[model samples]
Target: MEQTEDEGYHKLDHQLCFPLYAASRLVTKCYQPVLDELGLTYPQYLVLMVLWESDAVNLSRLSERLKLQSNTLTPLLKRMEELGLLTRQRSKQDERSIIIALTEKGKSLKSEVPRLQQQLMDIGISKEEAIQLKGLLTKMINYISG
Candidate 1:
């Protein structure tokens, strides 16, 4: 009997998806130590980024911006609250709605973030290339997301 090859699997190097997946995981690992110092997880950092841009957004808006569902945001928000980073409160006008506002501690984190961002950029990525990469990623994300 002759052995036949299965077409389902391809060389890892030839698969474009693997590189993106691996790069995403690798980048998250790179951020892990820095984020751990601040008592944040990677996803929490994403939420913080959203809040940093808009301090007093409602939960729905925050969820939408982060592309997270309420179930995921709820636990993350609880952890952030315990850390005294942010507060989640029911809106006075609407019982169904919740608002997320940064505590002073959370607001203070914004200043430190740019330095961390710079540190990441310094790690084997040129400034010009970083900008170009960001543009490409942004375009790709928008194209797929939309």
Candidate 2:
């Protein structure tokens, strides 16, 4: 009996993208409890991380940095603002431009990041392995983006 070309190759586990997608979802799931303590969702946490690095950035700049669209980000930003975590206001220099700035509450969340990171790292990957994985993923991202 001859095996068809599709027989072995069609398995989901054999696909490169499947593991990456699964890992991404699993990692995000692990983050849920940690983020919940701070009343944040994963995307909201990511937005806060960017703002923590640069306190005030225009919407376009933020959207570019986060690799998200304004339409998607706008609703997230509005929710964050409503939560008293951050604020969005029109830039004085350009009325058309909107600036996003972290509030005191937002700034306070930076202290919790280390704990969240540690919790994720507890999944058994060593520091060196984590760094290497991050580097590989970043390379893949850059290549695909290019």
Candidate 3:
């Protein structure tokens, strides 16, 4: 009934979550310099990317898309608004909902994204591997979220 030391349950490597957490942080760190040039934090960059794709989206829809709660998104949106990167307006059809639209400034940042994506791609992940990794990660996320 004895378990080997390698089977130790408390080790950091034994936790499935640890690698995911560490990798997320490291990958984000690699993005810091490029993000700094755009004057955006990682989360803010994510928000901008989403808005660039679906401008004039409502708060709840945006929250769903980003997997963020409305409270968490509100403050970030406020900061982006103050930076003149976006505008927040009450939805005419539903006063209870807020619509988010990127300002010209925010839309302009989209042009920089291709360069950022290219830089990351150059960091050694092959196209096939990148596709596979994305598929695996998306599957894990869907399973976990479900």
Per-prediction CA RMSD (Å):
4.7, 3.5, 2.8
Per-model TM-score on C-alpha atoms: 0.83, 0.89, 0.90
lDDT of 1 by residue, 1-146 (tens): 23224633455665657978988898888788778888889898888888889788899998878777999899989999999999999999998999999999999988878756754765577889878988998888778778
Clash statistics: count for each candidate = 0, 0, 0
lDDT of 3 by residue, 42-144 (tens): 9999989889887778999899888899999999999999999999999899999999999999999999988677557665678899899889999988897
Residue 114, candidate 2: how far off, in angstroms?
Answer: 1.4
- Candidate ranking (TM-score, best to worst): 3, 2, 1
Q: How many backbone clashes does candidate 3 have?
A: 0
Model 2 vs. true fold: TM: 0.89
Off by over 4 Å in 1: 1-9
Candidate 2 lDDT by residue in tens digits, 33-138 = 8899888999999999999998889999988877789999999999999999999999999999999999999999999998788668776688899899999998
Q: How many Å off is the CA of 1 in candidate 3?
A: 20
RMSD, candidate 1, Å: 4.7
- Candidate 2 worst ten-residue window by lDDT: 1-10
What is the overall TM-score of model 3 with all chains considered together?
A: 0.90
Task: Give candidate 2 regions above 4 Å deviation.
Answer: 1-9
Superposed model 3: Cα runs more than 4 Å off: 1-6
- Model number with the top TM-score: 3
